[model samples]
Target: MNLPTASRQDGTYPRPQQLRAHWADLTGVWSFRHDDADAGLADGWAHGLPDARDIVVPFPPESSASGIDEPGFHPVVWYARTITRDDLAVAGLGTGRPRVILHFGAVDYGAQVWIDGAFVGRHEGGHTPFSFDVTRHVTGGAAHTLVVRAEDDPFDATQPRGKQDWHETPHEIWYRRTTGIWQTVWLEAVPETHIARLRWTQAGPAAVTATLHLDGHVPAGGSARVSLRFDEVSLDTVEVEIAPPARRVDVTVPIARLRNGQAARELLWSPEHPRLIDATVSLRAHDGAVLDAVSSYLGLRTVAVDRGAFLLNGHPYDVRGVLNQGYWPQSHLAAPSYDTHRREVQLIKDLGFTAARIHQKIEDPRFLYWADRLGLLVWAEAPGAYEFSPTAVQRLMREWMDAVERDVSHPSIVTWVPANESWGVQHIADEPAEQAYARALADVTRALDPSRPVISNDGWEHQNSDILSVHDYEGDGAILARTYADEAARRRLLDRMGPAGRRLLVGGAPDHGQPIMLTEFGGITYQPDTERDDSWGYTEAADGDDWIKRITALYDAIRASSFLAGSCYTQFTDTLQETNGLLTAARVPKMPIEDIRAAVTGRRKQR
Candidate 1:
């Protein structure tokens, strides 16, 4: 069944009353309809065009919950809404302040935003958030019109489009395209002289530092007071002198307050414990006046790859994780609510998996936030298509830089995987360029966030990487780990199949002490409805009981192998056309949850 749709201009997701305490999701009915090809919304013709047609906010027009469930034809989807300065005032915007910031959670492909009658800004990336300062556009208490025009070519090869196959009916590997704004749009007020941005890091138990960049001017005070709260309790409060351009503000909180060291034991956030601590930060003037306050949260957890074993909290830990694409049956690329997003993460955790490799797509910031709080480890990956251009790679690198800059603060993100299996690199005959791009991304990612490990390319050629990775789906579980019958048998197998067969035999879990991860494997598709077909992992109608046995045996072999560190199962949920998933498309549990948990956690079944 489809999710409920909201019908008000000022309503949030689900309803206005159940707003998430931490966020304000401006998702509801808005004025939207098809525009003429001659007169477009971008050319300021949308000023007073009285088209009160209904369109759901936050859901792409093509989605089932969008109220308009028709397929978008790659045409420009135009949206216009008449919002007053007072609208911003209710959201703590334009409240006697000369500066206001309007933030869009995400927009597909390219978008142009016009506030009132003037153009504000345009952004390119379809998966990341962007904002525009629209204070000057507001004229007194009068009404202002905001218009956004978005265009998306879902099959654009060079762009980082993941699993979005336009022009094709529902297929095996790809699903529907989500265009226009699929996330929230909200405005917040900030003082004329205020802290514009902050990049911070936690060095140790007691110390944390941030480099603040003020937008226009710092407040008229030499000292700025900073306060950090953890769930209503102040964790750290300190006063520091403001540097003109910028200065690093360092604060030391008690070990109990920071909870950095205690996390290893008492308060460590883990799937088993799932402890979360809130942090609300506020910048203040020397006179004890609060300047700006934004709610934030942090988890204290560390992941390391050492001695050919993955370690969490300084102990050898095996990661039974899944490769989650983060797509929904109805919402497609977007989750209907923060609760919906949180439910997915909780499902991963509930399945006895400690981590998840978010495959092929840069997820919404909320996913990372939920992972951090819910104690689910994440391996953030960049979307890789079958083609790549140098110019496109450069832009991708820039977006990756921004993604890292924005996501580095979260403890749940343990690794950065820049490419998946060298899909596009193969097209380039010059091996040097391909290797250079791979190495360059590794270098840039490491330079950007040295704390996390970076996997160069998931599988394919394996050019250069901090960790040796493979995507193996060899024979069934029994044959994959079994010793090759002989050199002739191995050669015959290699000759019959392609490079994939060769990699399975030759790679054999790298002998080097460096970490070895089965980044992709075990995509057993179990479609009970189609029982004639027996390939349970990748095909429908496979033997349900046999599927479980094979997967469990595969996990057993990998867990016993000394060379392998961890394995991420093919997927968590069955995405649209790809039915190889542990759970059904709607995220309903397929097999017994206890059985899957037993296989993953290595827990001995009770007698």
Candidate 2:
């Protein structure tokens, strides 16, 4: 049967693992209405919002890609769509009493989902995926009304807003706010007992440890089996007896055995050679009848910080990274298409950068998938809250946990940054409570994924961090070199500058033994076209030659530091008023692409 897929621009789902599965994409035109007074529930709009106009799904109303092209702040927005059983059947789902799950890639702030006017579930946190089982509310060969209500308060300092502008207009570094559904919505069919979550971790370079979490009870005398394969070649098969009330099962596979006496390095995953292993997990009854099956993939790699160096697969790996805000000119926070993400990753690789600090945004899963497939290291960072109140801390911690859980499976993500430059926890250097909070976040991240490094706060005042990072946009390369000439001089300058200077290094003053990186620098402003008064960068350059000269000098300063392991340029593309990007907002190169690549790869000397 020809499966019915979403007519989305990219014609794909955000999660690649779900592509061949029994699922239907619901990301097209939908009835939309703005609720300024939060009166949708009071007025019984969940039954149907017939008067609402049409707006595309998976794109915010503020984004031009949504077809609304309205960039106003709407605290509440309502969306309504009608789906029939045929719609599910066409997508190869909703058959044979299967459990139908409604999934939302993401909805801004808080979301309430209802099917046929019956409230199914509600979810908080704007950037994480959530789902609800709607089988009871949905009937085969019948029409069902699906309504979604999203409430977002841009000005709420208690919420993690990230770079979304809280004001009515874009200001400073923040851009337009994403209001309603900004990601894909879909439906999937699963068995009574299905695989709920899969966690993969590499044990050394030749062994992989996996944990499978089942969503439902296993039948009596049934067992769970998992098969590992690489390039369609079977490696190992393991089976576990069904245990009552135990929802989790652990299995370890030795990949070296599959190599047949070959070198173990062939199975390792890195930027230069990204190798992935596919797996099929199944739950079988006593008669050997397959009750459930799901397909997933994993990459064997390990990341750690060893003796002031970032180690990837137990080897010292220098991180050549760029700052990516995960924004598009048309879609704002939402990517215009899945291909857009793929192209961005390829472009970063072409630009001679091995890694990208996904700045202040939990990126789309598709982007992380491409990063894994194309081999680009990523530093997953959490959106920031401007305030340090208890509510803000609680909100950030909860949302960050969800974010980590959502992207933990992606092998390309080598580092987890809970905070950036102390944006929300501003008083961490002085306030003991804030310091404790930062440390707690780092601890939580390490506990969640012990294989990867966690940067408590990427930039300054790091209470607990696997890597010591700082953001120094010192325009003059000579001064920057002098500032970090030696460990003692760096500490003296940091202490004298104090916390107010934004240069103070808190939490033990960056011992030379820990991994250090200049996470943000070389924000040379270059606008080839007419420069508006609002457009600004860190330091302005006269032309392409001057820009190249300044950037190369900054790179030289970073390369000269014996303690510094890596550096990330200001950004990959121009975002809003910030023009300090290697590429223009339209993805156009400002200077010669090869020249920029040479500067970043350390192939060219400062001249």
Candidate 3:
């Protein structure tokens, strides 16, 4: 059976800076073969795979969208597709001696790319984007063979696998494993000296700072100019001269100057009013001719933590959030379409959630784009490995750094979570090395992007964390109310049994000043399909009305706590057999949306 596909636009991936660059979508069917024996390399399979089966690009073989529909273990897989000269020509790569780059949105575990049977590059880290220049490997008017090898070991604890099931079948909380490509694959044409990266920051209430990284070489006396806009209205234009061997340039634009003495707050961004500003950057030759141009956007906002409260734009903001796993029933990690991202964020907002903790996964940039446009706060999390080893630490650190660098410019992402529930560093509280690693991760995150708060080890272990967060699954509201009635009482409880009774704090003295949040709770399971014996939830609800009552009570308990800044409900949608979600796996509401919204927003009480 075929799974439903998402509505995709022409150019959906590579978000944050949706540049107006020459590009082509390399999705759809491709030749596929399972390298069970791992003999593709010795077999010279990169040259061709004529006997291979057909599968869709960007969707893993385990997914129905790939046309494989086999969820069993496949350690190694190979994909082959032919890129014709027309494909390159359409992307402006056929002439002008432009560089042709092949971009892979994400590949599972490990990936190797070969062009025209020549090894181009290899990349590790399953959930990050990687690219290679294939200009030299392809002829201008001829077809070239593109091949990829993906290797994944789901049982290997050294790699960050998130919730991918290690067993042959789905179990407990883990779901089916994803293998091979699971995101968009595309091609782009760029000048030899092109804009490599664009990083933006709100310098102050009145200005935005943009840092540009250039690749290749720049001729002497070349220059670059940036044009700023707000809602299509011209803001300001800044220019900078570039010398040969130059790579980095910084430019700041003052909004007041663009608004003709208007205050910066006139165009401030908030959840209630998501205002975005567009920017276009152009590189020029000494003769003032435009060599390259790319388009991007930014939202003007600031986030801070002050006195046990999360502040947005200098005002205390309560984070009514849900734990979004970023999983789909059919596509697994990949969204069915770019529109699905917008709809999901809209659903969260419609359900009265102001924020969402993208739990245990580095989500797609398109999803973050919608979050920014729709004004939804996000807690970006790094997927965790199950074991504590040197390899695990290295992999986690590299991928986490990549994730942070890729998402730092997004205004919707207010927080960074490096570890969750002590998944990888389980002995962080007892082992000095683990504690050091966790602290190092937190430090690295802050060093890369200090504007946002970092929850070092969310849901327990309180080492080097900006926010004091805990996860408790107790179903009783009275218990939650009594446990966190006051800061003194909460500290005493932490001293006695530690957070979650696991000794989350090393010295037993909790950080009194940091904001406290119930990061995870209220996993009341409601299995609408009672006939499925395999389905399960964290805690069973007696009925729909009982579920509402229990959920409302938990929200009330959270609101009543003097020390709590906010809370995140267990999850947004169900996945696999874990049916503890406000929305079912198919994105259907299990209960009245208004009732849940009332409970979450604290507008009404259940009699």
Per-residue accuracy of model 1 over 1-607 as CA lDDT, tens digit each: 1112111112233212112122223567776755536357545554544555677887887788878776656456777776764576565554435577778877887888886667888998777778887777864557888878787766567767666775646566677888888878876566666555555465675555554556655555645554455435555666666665553344433335445554436545666665544433445666766665544445555666777667775677777779998888677787877677678888998888989998877787667766766678888988765576876686678777777877776677888988877766663324677767877888899998887677777764444466656677753655655522333533443334323642421222233455667778778777655332223345333476777776787787676564667789887988766778888878887787877787777785687
- Regarding TM-score, does 2 or 3 come out ahead? 3
CA displacement after TM-score superposition, residue 515 of candidate 1 (Å): 0.7
Q: Compute the lDDT for candidate 2.
A: 0.82
Rank candidates by TM-score, best first: 3, 2, 1
TM-score of 2: 0.94
Q: Which candidate leads the pack in lDDT?
A: 3
**Tens-digit per-residue lDDT, 1-607, candidate 3:** 1111111222265554646445777888999999888898999998888589999877888988778988998999999999987788766674443788888888998999998898999999999888898888875547889999999986798889888989998988888888989888888888888888888887766778888889888888888888787766788888889877879888887776534435656566777887777787878888987777777878888888988899988889999999999888788888877688889999999899999999878888888888888889999998889999988999999999998888888889999999998898877778888888888999999999989999888888778888888888888989888877897867765666654677546634356588989989988898766545677766778888889888988988999998888889998998888889999988988887888898789888467
Error of 3 at 180 (Å): 1.0
Candidate 1 regions with alpha-carbon error over 4 angstroms: 1-24, 33-53, 94-98, 228-235, 247-264, 427-430, 483-512, 529-541
Better of 1 and 2 by lDDT: 2
- Per residue, candidate 2 scores C-alpha lDDT tens digits across 1-607 of 1222211113256565433356787989999999988889999999989578899888899988888888887899999998877767754564432777788988989999888889999998888889888878885547899999999997898888789998888877889998879988988777778777777777654667778788787878878887787776788887777886779877777775635535666776799988877777777788888777766677777888998799997789999999999988788889887678889999999889999999988888888878888899999999998999889989999999988887888889999999998888877777788888888999998888888899988887777688878888889989788767777755665567632276545655354467878889888889998586888787899998999888888888877876778888998999988999999998988987889988888796447
Instruction: State the C-alpha lDDT per candidate.
Output: 0.66, 0.82, 0.83
- Supply candidate 2's per-residue lDDT for 319: 96
lDDT score of residue 507 within candidate 3: 30
